[model samples]
Target: MAYRTWQCENCGFLYEEEFGLPLEGISPGTRWEDIPDDFVCPTCGFAKSQFSMIEI
Candidate 1:
């Protein structure tokens, strides 16, 4: 599986994980493409573009 990194729009929280099925209680059957571009940050409800991909 491929790994992906995601940044938080609110507090700039960077998170990384393997690409696979979504975790329980967080997202249901959520794929990379399925995620909405206007998705809001869980902590501060910021827009999706506010998040940046973290390159390792």
Candidate 2:
């Protein structure tokens, strides 16, 4: 199945649903919206709301 991608607005961090961040404890196939609000960008500490969904 195809996965959705999200990009951080402040630091340009890319979050792909198909390949969840194992280091961060987020499992694969987890949707962008399913992530907790308190989850920050691993790269720049940006808030979850700062992430925008991408087509590809």
- Find the candidate with the highest lDDT and give its number: 2
Per-model TM-score on C-alpha atoms: 0.55, 0.89
lDDT of 1 by residue, 1-56 (tens): 46567787569854444533244223533444556676666667787678777776
TM-score, candidate 1, is 0.55
* Candidate 1: C-alpha lDDT: 0.59
For residue 20, model 2's alpha carbon misses the true position, in angstroms, by: 0.8
List per-prediction Cα lDDT, in the order shown.
0.59, 0.90
What does each candidate score in C-alpha RMSD? 3.9, 1.4
Say what the RMSD of model 2 is: 1.4
Candidate 1 residue 10 C-alpha distance from true site, Å: 4.2
Candidate 1 residue pairs in backbone clash: none
- Each prediction's number of clashing residue pairs: 0, 0
Q: Write down the TM-score for model 2.
A: 0.89
